[model samples]
Target: MWENKIRCPCSRCSNNKFLCEDKVTEHILNRGFTGAYTIWSLHGEHDVGQSLRSRDRVEPYASNKEHEEYGEPIYDEEIENPYSRMVKDAMGPEVAFNYGCENESRLQRLYMSCKTAEYMTWHVQNQSDDGVLKHPIDGEEILSRLNSLPDLPFGTKCGDQKISGYGVSHNWVKNSILWDLPYWHMLFIRHNLDVMHIEHNVFENIFNTMMDVKGMTKDNLKARQDLKVSCKRPELELMKNNGKIFKLKAAYTLNKEEIKKICAWVKQMRFPDGFASNISRCINEIDYKFYRMKSHDCHIFLQRLLLIVFHDMVPHSIWDAITGISHFFRDLCTTEILVDHMEALQGKICETICKLEKIFPSGFFDSMEHLPIHLPYEAKFGGPIQYRWMYPFERFLQHLKKKVKNRASVEGSICEAYIIEEISSFSSWYFEPAMRTRLNRMPRNDDGGDVDSQGRLSIFIHFGRAFGPLEKSRFLDEDEFYAAELYVLMNSEEMLPYIKMFDEIIKGDVVHISEDELEKVRDARFVKWFKNYVATRMDEIDPRILEISHGPGRMIMSRPDTPLEPVTTVVVS
Candidate 1:
């Protein structure tokens, strides 16, 4: 197939170009063989496939060429771990952390397979240079530092020395394991901040400081003491009351009554299915402190609920600052990121941080607060925050933790359960779509799966289902019936045409029907007129429209689906 000219397996060429035998030899001598290319699969060497499902398969033979070039592998028996053994003997078999150097050969793994090699250098290959901080490579600080690496030794003390006036240099504590790779310094994003935990930490700091939670809050006696040295705010200054120290309320913090109001609101709040965890579970109405809120809980609070809950409760300046920070996060973590918008976000985040700094005590401005300034830049390159966040990894860790059945052999039990799960997941691919598999499984609140396509209007095709046990059922009264029916007809997309027809009829009767009055009239008469209108077009319209036109049944079933003590789900029969 090659016509005696084989692909050059050099590090630079990476088996990408066909070269004569002499050229191939020359390239290999100049650039070394492509990393981990021992198999020679492209050069007529067959690769042995090993199924993850089977454990009895014979181990593939290691090439003698590899043995000749790299030397024999080091066995555990040859390398002694006296320190580890001594620790095990003293500590009763405690697990010792592995502090080992990065394997030089492992760098090959990134370029070993052609499938992944291209993606490994994607930032370099597909770099955008239109002055947008659209990728890790565009992060000015990191890009410049990485590109203009100092000539000093990787882990030398010289890299840690203090500059003339600036504090001691903390750039390189120790050489990173990644520095073993020749191209490590060239890569734009060597590490990513877990936005999940950063947001969670930032939220905790804000919530704790604002609520004035004892012990947990950043605004404690020490912070107040520091404030005495840091700021000129006399209201927040510490007071000596009969030898007992007291700190006055900062303008940013909620008073006891305000905290109570916010707590009561949260205590009675409810969320839809799959939106967020039970936030009310963490709310303490008595203490006015949220307890046991997880990362995801904080995520929901910071992004969706912070501004709503704090509205009108705090002073305007405080509220505006909180709103700015809250909005910064909401925009930062969205599913789609626009580069142009990200630049605007850069300014917004800086302004938000500045606003926060003006309101919050010095203690509140931790590294996490500073971290947001870099986030928009990271988002420009990294794309959506979801892919880089720890939510999925943390959830998977929880899943792995659940898999441990044997206390004595935690790893073994987890491995066994994991393999079984993988097998089941793999097997599910072949299962019929109608059958329940992980992929086709319905949510707890699924409204009975698409409702039969035939003889159904699009409005009826999609609707919510109440999941909790029914709490109450009552028939609607005259006023309730009028309001309920109007709400249904007004909201239904399928009923929009009938609503327009009714509007025209109203316009014909009343020469000047203002939009506001027309809306009111529509709300008053649309339900009854829609029924008669749908009746006239019953021959052409779907039967569902007629059913909805008559309005929902008076029997309303209210159910509390969430942890919050509120009636969230209403089913009108």
Candidate 2:
């Protein structure tokens, strides 16, 4: 009979050391039992079983149990003797504990234990070999060598079948080496060659296919010859200037007669629309006159005409007359002082007109029957004259005296008086203490009425008093005093019959007045006398254009009383 098994006499197995020595020896020899079994058995069966169950659950999910269990200790075993107590002590605790757990566990636990052992053995072997492993070869090299051939020539066949060269082929050409082969055969062959060892012969069939030539063919030679000949033609030719083709030509040719005719045509043209056409004609005339006379004064006059036409005309006439004049003068004259002056005057006039429009109240001039004052004075002095007893009474009395002397003078004198009263009224209104306070509260340069300059105030006063009552004695004659009064009457009555003619000339609507009525109105003594006076002074008020055409006179006085200086002569023999 087999002796009952006994634990080994080592310190770890001492608790179960009751068996025969032969049985223990047999167990160590046959079962490969280690000295740590005794200590492993000290853990209770329930504890060991629970540990094994826990390990069985963990092993399937563990990534690195083998490395954790054996890897580091295995390396330590190489440094220390495997049989030494210090080595066993270090390795035994963990191994014995694992073995106890494994023995009590189920088959699933055993499988994981075996897998861990196998993986640990592999890791150890790899570590021992320093990581260089050999790979096996199959028939890959034969396939590679078979793919290392050049492309076949175009229209060539290998044995009985067609081969592709540059493109896919459906039929075989006789004498081709790569008949019925896919295009990949040539790609593989080219790609497999060593860079330094590749031969020109390898690409000979490809070159032949590209050239559409076969059997030891020359490639691209005809193309190269054509390119060389094309290059030589450019060097052999002479270049000419092509710039003259792009230049613009002159518009028209004009001789002296043609130019003079053009000038006359422009001058004779009628404008019936006031001075617009006349201004343009003058500009053109001045331009032609400049070319004929070569005078700076003619050019200056042309510039002035251009400014007048441009500044005054409406859109319809401006384009036809003014803009045309400006363009013509721009071509002729280099200097333009007259144009500058006209432009400045236009700006000043527009500004003055705007100021007048704002200052004067509407209907200010419609009926100044209570006073004979100018419209400007009505704005500036209307309030002051109404409040002042002396001025308004004097004005009313003057109007009455003028009316009694000549019934025609009544309307004009009363109108002037009314205008003066209104202007005086406006001045007194502006100068009131409340109004002055309001004006002072405004900003320094604000639009409120704060008269800063004494000169400007004087001008305002002058403007206000322009049509106010003056001493009757100051007039040269009663006709002179009633000049404006007669004008008002004539504009209202005598100018009516020629209304259509005036409208045609002025390009405005006409109001009808009979000729007989105009004659009757003109028969008034003051009207007749004023007309004669104006006629006599017309030359003084108007400039004579013809006089300026001649040279200005030089004053020469004879001084016969003084002796003239004698001429000295040098004697040359």
Candidate 3:
């Protein structure tokens, strides 16, 4: 196939011929190129078959080939700590911090103003005819209202002034940087009730109740049910087979006395692998335990670990409500941002709130902890919940805070370290094979040294960038393969020598990026599938330009699905 494309130097067709597209293909191929890749295999370049990227990356390399590529890193870690390769559990929260820096940037201040405006607007618009707020108040608002003229949030509250039928709990909003921003008057964005804060408050409410902590216990305990009959499980085939009915024991319940006993019990309780030690410590500290527990500790305890704890405790309806809310949030945090999905997520949150209302007395929700109900609309209309999530910024703060090594001049230390990191990160991009990733080293090919899977020096463009003509040359990491496929498709060539030799075909879909082309696809299901398929496969497939066929079934071309990129992976709970 390559030989036929070469222009004949013998001159029979030289002067009349234009030396078309075939000539270039012929020249590159027939020029006696040393082609080790003329043959190929789906089994891959592994000695016994595996990609150069190490398998069992989290544990240890699975075989010699994997060990050759990646074992050194694991070995180095083990040299420092013998158990490094084993699964290690974290004792505390890692994703976010309980507190953030007091200082705010000008941009942050602008966002705060927008937030304040939006919050005030939403409440004003939703206020009832009776002059009461339709929903619960928040901490910031309470702080603002209670503040004196000389206090941080001045003018918001005077001595005994009330707001939305509630008295302020404190006097401090001076830390609210937005109060002085120029755009404060024009802002109309919702005050972002951070999900982390909402979750923390809810957990505290439940925890305080569970321990029957002094001044924190509620008469209408949401999780209490010692005197009532609860829902029963349906009779199953086990009872039918025995020709007898087996009764279930009453569901667990606790009173003030029982809770106090459990609090003592908790001091001696030993949790399994996943729990933090905070659960046990809270036992003796119930009087003011809220002061010790950080937001994330409370968050994890209530959202994930509480379900197991409740099995041995009470059958309070409030506990069920809290569990429902926790489950909804778990879904909210991880769900992909499809419009339909977002709407459904919002619906679920609303339902959870309704359930909360049913379980708790009205006054129980009259605090800022209830502010999260308003967040769903914002999340649905705006984007994925992560876009509004605090964890990323909170996690970054962990990195930023670490940069400060000197106490004498903490700000200077942080600034200098930050500048140094910026310079180093920028300098890294100019290196021979720039590492755009967080990985400290380059990828391994089949060789002992860094290279592409094909054993060539790999030129990776971090997060993709464009260069060269024909558009496809700017790659999604397989330019050569992409170009070859395009060449075969557009050129009317019978088959390329490489293809004929290997008898192989690439096994993935091609997505045309044109909006016009996508609009032709009208089937919602196919569009959704195609989108999700593309989203999930971007890392695996050759992601350059065009040419598409969907096996004649999938594709309705208008729209679809980011964590790097969000799909439907649920939080395991």
The candidate maximizing lDDT is 1
Error of 1 at 444 (Å): 4.5
Error of 2 at 479 (Å): 40
TM-score per candidate: 0.60, 0.13, 0.36
Model 1, 1-573: lDDT tens digits are: 288788899999998999898898899899999999876777655555556324423222334455567897433355444544534565675566878645543434444444345555554357665655444445454555655655422221212222242334654444557787655775556678889989999999998888888888888877777876888767777899899988887777788898888888887777765788778888876677889999999999998889887887788888888888888888887665678888899999898888887777777777888988998877776666776788898899999999888899999999999999999976766566578878668766556666745766655566554456877688878887777777776777777777788889999999988999998887777776777767787889866766776776878877876423344655666
Measured over all alpha carbons after superposition, the RMSD of each candidate to the real structure, in angstroms, is 19.1, 49.0, 32.1
- What is the alpha-carbon lDDT of model 2 when measured against the actual structure? 0.34
Task: Point to the candidate with the largest TM-score.
Answer: 1
lDDT (10s digit) by residue, model 3, range 300-397: 77767666556556656656766777776676565443445555756777777887655443434646545766665555444455656686889788
Regions more than 4 Å wrong, model 3: 1-189, 215-291, 432-573
lDDT of 2 by residue, 399-420 (tens): 5565443466766766776677
Q: Could you give the candidate ranking by TM-score, starting with the highest?
A: 1, 3, 2
Off by over 4 Å in 1: 1-177, 240-244, 427-436, 439-444, 452-457, 463-472, 475-483, 495-555, 558-568
Ranking by lDDT: 1, 3, 2
How well does candidate 2 match the true structure in TM-score terms?
Answer: 0.13
Cα lDDT of candidate 3 equals 0.46
